[model samples]
Target: MSALANAPFYVTTSGGYLLVLAIILPAVAVLAMLLVPPRHVARIAFAVMAAGLAVALVIVAELVGTGMALAYVVGGWQPPLGLALRADGLSAAMLAMTAVVICATGLFARFHQCLEPETQDGRAATTFWPLLMAIWSALNAIFVGEDLFTLYVALELLTFAAVPLVCLDGRAETIAAALRYLMFALLGSLLYLLGAALLYGVFGALDIHSLSRLDGGAPAVTVALGLMIAGLLAKAALFPLHLWLPPAHAGAPAAASAVLSALVIKAPVFLILRLVLDVAPSSAGPLAGQIFIGQILIGQILAVLGASSILFCSVMAFRQQRLKLMIAYSTVAQIGYLFIVFPLAAGTETLPAWGTIAWTGGALQLVSHALAKAAMFMAAGAVAEAFGHDRISDLGGFGRILPISALAFGLAGLSLMGLPPSGGFIAKCLLLTAAVTGGHPWLAATILAGGLLAGGYVFRIVDRALATPAVELVARRPIPRRLEAVALVLALAAVGVGFVPLQPFGFLQLGRPAVSAMVAP
Candidate 1:
């Protein structure tokens, strides 16, 4: 049977058309926005975000209702010839995250323009709407693509859609940042394509499901895996190769910054996870063992980098003159948390495989970060809008000036700090437990240190935001309730994640690969 025919799901059994709509609506919206006048941009973008979000929600509802993945075949052809899109639990989670972040960004940007056109045509606004739509479509595609070739196309589309968003304002610096982002991402893409080519050459097939089922591995496989992972790490901005991140992310407008930081960088990371867990060979044979060792070794290095980033970046954030810069650095620290899961849960399959706590924690971190970071960035954008600047020290107080925005910022900070009843806290707690149980002292230490640093940095902004503006900081445009409320909802969602059962969620394992072949010891 074709892979599409075997897909698992939750709601209605429909999968193909919904996936098509999820990808199409965004592209169509982008085109429509491009054709509309600037003044009509916000309305058009809002309508698109609403519709896109609805599509995303339906995908989850369907997935949950059927308790299986939904699948759609392109051109009515099966895999190995035609392409298929499958939304498994992981993809559904990612899809939901993308929808939330994109929707929030649209709402936040409704109050401002990146660079409105000079004419009545509103060309810039029109242009941005479509680009945003294009980006949403690309992200969804990346999450759902079942074939390596299909995924490669999705990654490229994501890159093309995203790079332009960085320079939407058309300023010289923003343009420079966008170019740097573009060049680095292209390099990453080259590496990924090289690996994909090698895979096709070896297996004569580029479908992940097919490859994993075939259990292919060897010198060529290792080499291809290395190239692909290296490429994705650079794309995801894992330290050392992360030279392009802060500038590109921090330089973008607030709404844009939120989406870029909270969502875009994650695409490559998601790909890496798929390669390692689903594609890479997992055995104790010299070659297979070597690959696992490499992953664990790299995971440890990443944990250290994450710890240092939290410490150093938090201090740097504290010293920042601009609020946006501080948040940008915080993005670095948050990225670190994603890596910690590597060392903690990525060992040999010994002693029940460190249980499922670590696995669940990592997924939690990814999702929660999406919600908290998106909300925080939107909140920060509101602060800048109200005060005309993000000067941390000078903006003595914003709580009095924009209560709702400040509150949203504070709530988001709570999650980032890993406080109780917040998803960040639940995520960290699970990771820490896993580290201790796995007997990884360093990983445990790093988790604690990261949390502490996060606390220090998050405090710096809240202090200023609540300080009661020295002279009653007046609102620039009366603190848009709609925008602030959007941020608030996101923050609440992050906190609610903490309420999810602490144990490993079966939903995450709906279609899990058999660990029998991969287990160590």
Candidate 2:
């Protein structure tokens, strides 16, 4: 039987067209921007943003209403040959998160540009719209793409679109940072392509569903998986390979920083999750001992790296003086929590990885970090815009001048610091519980240490915000309340995620049953 026949859920669903619309809408906007005059670019982008967000929402609604995954087979050809697009509960969540962040970023960028009316149609403004739309298109594609090669294409588009955003201001340092980012990203792409080529040579297929159905214990499979995971780690900016992130994120415009930190880095992490869970062999049956050893090695290695990232980077963040740099370092620290989930969520004889508390905790951390980090970046942008600099020590009494921005930053920090009644708190709490239950005490301690370090860095800023300056801080330029409100809304969303029941989320398990069944004995 063909792979599609064997895997029944691979068939297209009634609402599958929405997945195409989610991806194509933003791409069409990019093409439309090319045809329109420079002054009309932002308008076209705005319309597309609204439509794209609607499509994302409709897709989420479709998944919830039908209670099944959405799938579309491109050109009516089954996988291992033709392409497929699928949106499970996870993909739908990513799509919605992407839409919300991208739309907020669009508004934040528009408002920031409007502050200088004469330059509204200038090079930066004109370039930002098309690139932003391209990024949105790329993110949507990454979330839904089922073929490994297709995902690589989306990653390339994401990297190319993001590089220019980093250097939008044309400053010497920003240009250098963009070049560094481009070099690292291209290197990652090359490694990923090499791995995909190796996999195709061995299995004669690069489709995830097809690969998942086959035995994966061959030597070539091991090498290919390792290369691909390493490549994704570079793209995700996990510690030790994160040299390119701080400068690039710190140099980008605030809106671009929000997208890069909050969304762009997530695509690779998502792919890595798919690869480890979907393509790796099950630790059961005849080869159970070998497979179990391999799984432990991989999971433990990732967990150790994650622990290092959380502790080391949190300290780095605490030491940084510039507001954006501190947040950039904190992004790396927050990402560590996701990696630690691998070991904690390792499936047992009966339970699947997706059904674990650690899995839910990791997903919540990803979504909450995206919202909270984006809000923090936007708030920092407003601070820099008002005071003309981002040196935290120099911004004493900034809260007295930009009270709304200060409040937004503090609220966002609540999530980052893993404080009560915040999404970060629940996520970390679940992770801690899993670590303790799973007998991983060191991981639990690392989580606690990371949270404490995050609190320290966050408190440093709050202190500056409340401090009394010898000469009261003054705005170099007036910032509108609307721009500040955008950040506040996202911060609230991050906190709102904490209200979800503290159990394994059923929504995340929507399309995972087939894969879980295949992996089980």
- Predicted candidate 2 versus true structure: per-residue lDDT over 1-521, tens digit per residue: 14556545468899999999988988999998999899999999999999999999999889989989999988888888889999998899899999999999999999999999999999998999999999999999999999999999999999999999999999999999999989889888889999999998887888887787666446677778788888888898898888899999999999999999999999998998888887775313366667667767778888888899999999999999899999999999998888999999998757878878999899989999999999999999999999999998899999988888899899899999999788998899889999999999999999999999999999999999999889878899889999999999999989888877563288888777655565555
RMSD of 2: 1.6
* Per-residue alpha-carbon lDDT of candidate 1 for residues 1-521, written as tens digits (9 for 90 to 100): 13335552112236658888888888787777667666776677788789889988998888778777888877776566767787877788899889988987886676555322253245555566677778898999898888888888889998998898889778999899899989889999899999999988887777776665443357687788888888887788776677778788878878788888888988888887787666763323456556666666656666776666666676666677887888887777777777777667664564223236787787888888889988888888878877788888787777777777778788878778888888889988988898899898877887787777778877877788778665767666666578778888888888888888553366665545445734523
Listed in order, each prediction's TM-score against the native is 0.90, 0.97
Model 1, runs deviating above 4 Å: 1-13, 36-41, 113-121, 215-217, 282-288, 347-355, 468-472, 514-521
Clashing pairs in 2: none
Whole-model lDDT per candidate: 0.76, 0.90
Write down the worst ten-residue block by lDDT for model 1: 1-10
Best by TM-score: 2
